[model samples]
Target: MIIVITRPDFFEGEAAKIAQLLQSGRADLVHIRKPRASQSEVEQLLFSIPTELYSRLVLHDHHSLAIKYGLRGVHLNSRNPEPPAGWSGAVSISCHTLSELSECRRKPYAYMSLSPIFDSISKRGYRSAFSADDIAAARSQGLIDERVMALGGITFDKITEIKEMGFGGAMILGDAWR
Candidate 1:
């Protein structure tokens, strides 16, 4: 489960190419996290990608488009903490703390992202709140497990560490773009 998250701001000429390449490669899931994008904007972006790869896409906004376009699922964040009624396909969420991860695990989501596992490569000044020891302890205590995917600042080199920490996978953002 190697996941790739889209940059918040769309890169006019490069985003589609990168996304297609990622989908064709090892990314098991691709979270489309354009928060400021309108429905039309999102649609346009989706249109750019090949229809055959739509099943790998997970929407961070305009979730209704998931069904319309046959996307993978919808990702729940602070802005939208729950799935809209009638959403029956795969779902995912963002958890910033151990407690939130614990709570979200009880739900039937495909997976969840435990963010800031390392200092953010995309967002300046967003550092990890959990230490290596903390993650180890959490894994020992069963707090971190197969359903938890490490997010934030995850480069190719950090995947092994994240797996060792008991995360199901790594959700890449900046590293993929860079």
Candidate 2:
């Protein structure tokens, strides 16, 4: 799957246009990660998108809106490490280390993003935590699989490389937005 995460800051005037374009294109999922936005702001953003596209969105904050808006799922990050009690829809998270990935495999997530597979395009100086060799080794050891997606600095050119490294898919941010 090709997932696209929204930039943390709201896109002043182009948010709806960009989101609609992505929804009409190849993005399998769109993770809305507006960390500083209020619940009302998030609701407004959601309202701007067509209701038919609601099933393709995943909210990073105000998860209650997932049910309120009938979104595809909710993404757990540092802000929310676990799903609220009785969250029955799809849930996913970010794993920074092999250990976390291993643990996530035991959960019922649709997929998990294992990030910084390459230097971050959005975050300066955020280098990859694992090398190609490390990725290969992890795959060999059964740590990387179709449930773990590669994130960070992902461009069209890197998709094949990420697949070769045994990631299920790539999550596009900077590359897609650019």
Candidate 3:
């Protein structure tokens, strides 16, 4: 049940076909993280996906749009302190540390992303990265629960290690879908 979270920069060309392939594969979730995408663009992509795949679709930091379009939910970053109230859909937050994870625990998100399990090309500015041992320690410390997801530098090759570390899943950016 590997999940593939898509970044807009990595997925360009034949979006309809790509979306179909993404939905057809062994993906538990497909997070659409087009940070600057317009509402119309998002809707166009969302509607292209079949209703059966709706449960597996998640947006990036756009609760209003998700609600308006009847999409699954939104993924929030560290800056976003809280998910908007009244969102009944699944919400996921990105956390990089025990403190952030602790803060996230107070929120009502469906899951959390603990990133930098490996060095990441996407997050070039973040020098403080985590290893599997660090991730394990965080979990052991009770900073997060079993629903934590691994992000940042996660690839298909590392899926087994991620699962072994007791993470629920990994969020893909430049790896799986590319």
Candidate 4:
């Protein structure tokens, strides 16, 4: 489960890059997380990508596009915490704490992201919130499992440690864009 998160804002040739990542199997899913973009802007970006690969795309905003384009899923975030009404497709949420993860596990979701596992590279002051002891305790209690993805400050080099920590995958942002 190599899940990559798109940059917050669209960049030149961004769609092409996303198409390549999915087409080449570099990412199992790519979450399109433009918090401030217009619906038309997001639509244009989606149009640029090949229709055959739509199943690998997950919209973080303008979730209507997911249904309109038959995309893989919609991501739940602060901007769009609740999924679209009556949406039964693949749904994923973000959880910053093990408690949140534990609570959210009752719902049927495809996966969830645990963030700030390390000091963030994208957000200047977002330091890690969990210590080794905390993570170990969570893992021992069956909190950090395969359904969880490690987000924030994730890079290719840290994948081994992430896997060892029992994460299903890593959701890279700054390192990916850089």
Candidate 5:
């Protein structure tokens, strides 16, 4: 299960690219993370993609769009910490620290993303927060398991290590859109 996160800003042909990813099976899920876009703008983007693939796309903002379009899920971030009222479908969240990851164990989330495992390509100077030793230790302690995904700076080259470290999947942002 490889999840692809969209860029922060929208660009021409972006919807087509997202559709291609889903249609080609290149991404099991595509997270639309446009934080500043208007609801209408996001709807326009959604209208461009095939309706059948809506279930493979998750929204970072305008979660109403997710419910309206029957999207895959909603991603919780600092901007939107809770799912929409009565949202009962698949839900995921971002966790930046190991403690946050550990704390998420009791939640009923579909999965949780633990990020900054490597230097970020999309955000300059956003370096990795966890060392390999820390990751190994977390795995041995049963904190990193099949419900966790490695996000930030993920690329084709690191998928094997991510799997070996006990992550269920890799959440790709900078690497996938590049």
Candidate 6:
């Protein structure tokens, strides 16, 4: 199912609302992508979530913390090559190009996100380099995985179209909850 990983700056102080949204099935996965949050902030937010909902939540760039907080998994940035040795859990990575996609395939992570399908308001200075058709072509070539998600500039209105383009799901920002 398509998921919405909340960008912290936008979803600040809305963890409960976010949790409620996820719990109510408005989103499949709620990945907390807060780059500047302190450990305490993360801990507080995680603690606010009900355990029964843990299976559908993920943290970003904080693998150890996610484990400590009893979260489901983490979404790695492109910079991290692999999760620490002996770690056994669901781990996802962000990949923006075909080469990155090829590299992530060799890793043992559970899934990956191919992003900036369109210029995103959240990432103001960046522009999308690939068209949805380009992504579709790559998928057709069997370069991406069935678990791949299309991120950047995605909105609730675009979910159907993104799914139609063969993406397993979408990662959105600055849309509904912005």
- The 0-to-1 C-alpha lDDT of every candidate, in the order given, reads 0.86, 0.85, 0.71, 0.89, 0.90, 0.75
User: Arrange candidates by TM-score, highest first: which order?
Assistant: 5, 4, 1, 2, 6, 3
Q: Per-residue alpha-carbon lDDT of model 4 for 13-101, expressed as tens digits?
A: 89889988888877888899889899999999999999998998899999999988999999998888888886778999999988899
lDDT of model 2 at position 122: 88
Candidate 3 residue pairs in backbone clash: none
User: How high is the lDDT of residue 120 in model 4?
Assistant: 97
For residues 43-122, what per-residue lDDT tens digits would candidate 2 score against the true structure? 88888787888888899999999988788999998898877666788899999998988898888899989878999998
TM-score per model over all chains: 0.94, 0.93, 0.82, 0.96, 0.97, 0.88
Give residue 126's error in model 5 in angstroms: 0.5
Of models 1 and 5, which has the larger lDDT? 5
Please give the TM-score that candidate 1 achieves against the real structure: 0.94
Q: Which ranges of candidate 1 are over 4 A from the true structure?
A: none
Writing each residue's lDDT as its tens digit, candidate 1 over 64-158 gives 99989988899998787777678888999998998988888888988988988899999999999899898998899887889889998899788
**Model 5, 95: alpha-carbon shift in Å?**
0.4
- Cα error, candidate 1, residue 12 (Å): 2.5
Cα error of candidate 6 at position 38, Å: 1.3
* Location of the lowest summed lDDT over 10 successive residues in candidate 6: 78-87
Task: In angstroms, give how far residue 46 of model 3 lies from its true place.
Answer: 1.5
What C-alpha lDDT, on a 0 to 100 scale, does residue 72 get in candidate 3? Answer: 73
**Candidate 4 wrongly placed segments (more than 4 Å):** none
Give me the overall lDDT of model 1.
Answer: 0.86
Please report how far candidate 6 places residue 18 from its true position, in Å.
1.7
Worst 10 residues of 4 by lDDT: 80-89
